[model samples]
Target: MSHDKKCVVIKIGSHHTIAGFNNTELPQCILPSSYIKKGNDYIFGTINMLEECIDKYENESQQTLEIFTTVDENGIPYNWTVIEQQLKYIYETELKCNSKDFPLIITVPHLKNELANKVVERYFNLAFNKLNVPVFQIVIEPLAIALAMGKTSALVIDLGSSGCNVTPIVDGTIVKTSVMRSRFSGDFLDYIISERLNDLLKSDTFQMTDTDGDIILSNNDSTTRSLQTKDSIDIWYESNTWIQDFKINMLQVSDKELPELERYYKEQAEIQIRQQEQLQQYSTNNTEAKLDAAAIASITNNNPLSQKKNFLFKGNKNSKQTVSLELRECYQLSESLFNPALISDKYTKEDGLGEIIGKAIKKAGASVSSVGTNTVGSLGASMTIQPATNQSKNNNPFGSSIGGNASNNSTGGLNGGINSLGSSTTTPEHIYSTLLTNIIVTGATSLINGMEQRIIKELSIRFPQYKITTFANQITMDRKIQGWTSSVSMCNLPSWELAKWYTKTDYEKESNKDETKEN
Candidate 1:
């Protein structure tokens, strides 16, 4: 690999795509993996960008536009062309660079053998032929996570918008049979919040007097309006937009944290009420208020505990809408992740996220015991030159492929085989213990404020002995890039060239050999 040429890493998730040159701490382009084609003009990028474009076009009726996206319920790319376009947009438009100038390193999930093979084959063709690139490498998303966390092995729980993937990695390889998935994810939480917000809007407690409503509606600050809106309210077209914003800003706490914040709000409201009462007391004596009915009514109106609570929303038009939420209702929505019965009556014990984690861990432990520690993670092995198979069927360019035997490299990839230490381990119990100790939690779903803590608390009740590692701040909002960081770091190593694919000279030689064979 030449130092002069550009080296690029792309981390594509169900929600977003992150891309940048290697060695940078942060990615240059973080775009949503969504595209909408309206005639020849296409719309793609972050959700915010898409919203802006939608508003610009003012296309309230969405029936005419064709939407292209790769995300499925399980977070796998269903259409390779959509993914290819996303990458193409990043390379050609955002980065303003030719694909052939950069060696591409991309990430894929550990799933069905047939699916991964298809994805990899498409990538090779896209890079080598369409983009005219030099070399392409594929990294398993979970193994890249372990590398990013500076761990040889860990149980990675990726809670994404599409779904949750609980995978166990041992010495940098994913344990295929131990992997588990669930449909419940961040999108589910958003739906619950939206429902709860609508329910609150309809509650009698949310209504306010005309006078109180006037005071709240006149307030400039969103916080003051939120504090005062126990009165009247308005509903608008941006209900979903504001509900999402409120959840991101306010609903990041667990059930435990909610009570404390609620108490604080009550105390502050009481203090203000008491001050007003004191001012009124100075003006009139208690004995006089007994005879003066207006004074008595004023005192009755001063009770803070009975005051109206407010949730204020400002929409795209600067139009104001207000609703009130009971603190219990706010936190109860988040609990649906743990107790699916809260979301719907049909949910059983097996539907909970904790139950899914427990089952995945148990499966991983059993596989480790069965493999007997010597080859615990054979499925997640490092990249290697696979025996050249006939490419006419799939058009797979890299006879070299991933999911080979594990490599001993500390950084996790472009190595020979499973870690020598992993192969030499003697005790099955030790392997299980090691795998259970470091539970590396990553993905966009884990970004919710108290999400990591709640998962840890729930798992602790079930498995007290095993540790839970959330890698809290180690991952950014664009959690997919954590894996790209690891891959970038690993590829920068001097010895990475040992796993290099067909160089320009090598590609030429292979092309001639194939031509001769065809003749």
Candidate 2:
């Protein structure tokens, strides 16, 4: 008997992707061209690489392969092509169906050679032909993260190299996939950095070659010493740039001068405003307000669940479900996304980007609160019993005009000794009806752990007699810069202990087999 129940989640990353790679210590990727000009150049190269990966799949075709990319409403990438053969490695995933012990979510990358007739579509044929037990669920990455966070609702803002994506997750699921595609990320930040670096150097000419993504700095002056990220490139780019700007603007400026700068900025802004006013005639604006009398209308706008009308039901009966339903959008956040910032936030309170992310989640319209202890559980059992009157009657004789004690079991009666007993039958309405409270919160650190705490506290209150508990988790991520990294499991979670909320297992009936009926 296999005690090991295998559950997995795979998160593939761009950094892990291998396309036109040269892994021979010379360079990680040796593209045909040093500097890319046309977008097709990258695509064509990527396609060729995908073609090469088919050989690997041919060898281990037994594994279930599910190829999926984040989709727009229309199913296009960058509004162009969905990324399939991207990541060269693997990650984690959670399951779609409910499980008390939810499966560990994992990521699977479609290799460069894995692409056959398509780009990143996972080779599904393996599950049908090769693997005996294979299951698959495809979803957008950011959408998956929002789902995993266990939110009541939110608008997810995932800033990455692929793009700066904004998605609204209403209830526990997604309303639309197409409108959430973002085309800006840390890569865009890098581009901005490079552009700013050019402005700093006072040159219109410079070449940025990502030799295995090693940020190298070589000046025409020849003294910058080819600054590879291994030494200080990432430190300078990700961390130092912000510090440098803050220092340059604030260091020497006096408190008295600060007011002057503010005044000057205001005057400049006023002038700019006049110039913008002159241009407003040509500009277009149609803004939507948060509290417009149309919040419900807005909330229901992108709901995909509503589109799922009963294909079988013939009549136009109204539904009792007033809340918005969700379609599963399974995906993962890339671990390599802003590696340093995420790491830094996990360490300190100030400038905590992690908390900013958490706050963003709340701002997207979610209910958040700490859990307290309360408990209630209900069960009903029924059996038949003979009926009896609560009142006593006096006996009567002789005249027989009236009889207070007209006993049915008198000698004249045949089968009057028995009477029908009222049964204590239960109906569906008698169930311990309670709402599964959905709470969404985000902060500097331990957002998930905080959620767990809230969950434990709430469960304790909601079901006091039952024991709540949790299994230990050991998670890890990429390297860090400063501060001692307390073993890297649960990055968003702080120094939190394990806890669980167990249900009352001792029901009137007992069975190892869980038998649930479909309504």
- Where in model 2 is the C-alpha error above 4 Å? 1-4, 13-133, 202-519
**lDDT against true structure, model 2:** 0.25
CA RMSD per model (angstroms): 9.8, 26.4
Top candidate by lDDT: 1
Residue-wise lDDT of candidate 1 within 1-519, one digit each (tens)? Answer: 454445888877776777888767778888766666667766677564446444643544544554555767676777667666777788887778888887887776765556666666666666777767777767677766676566656778888766788887765556566788877777687566655654443433333323234433233445334532321111212323575567666555362334454676567755665676676667776523322456545655554334444667553333456765544555666666666777788886487778888777777666655655554343334333123333343223333244422223322123234444345543545655666677777776676668877777767776787665656544455465666676676556444553444445555565566567679
TM-score of 2: 0.28
**How high is the CA lDDT of each candidate model?**
0.60, 0.25
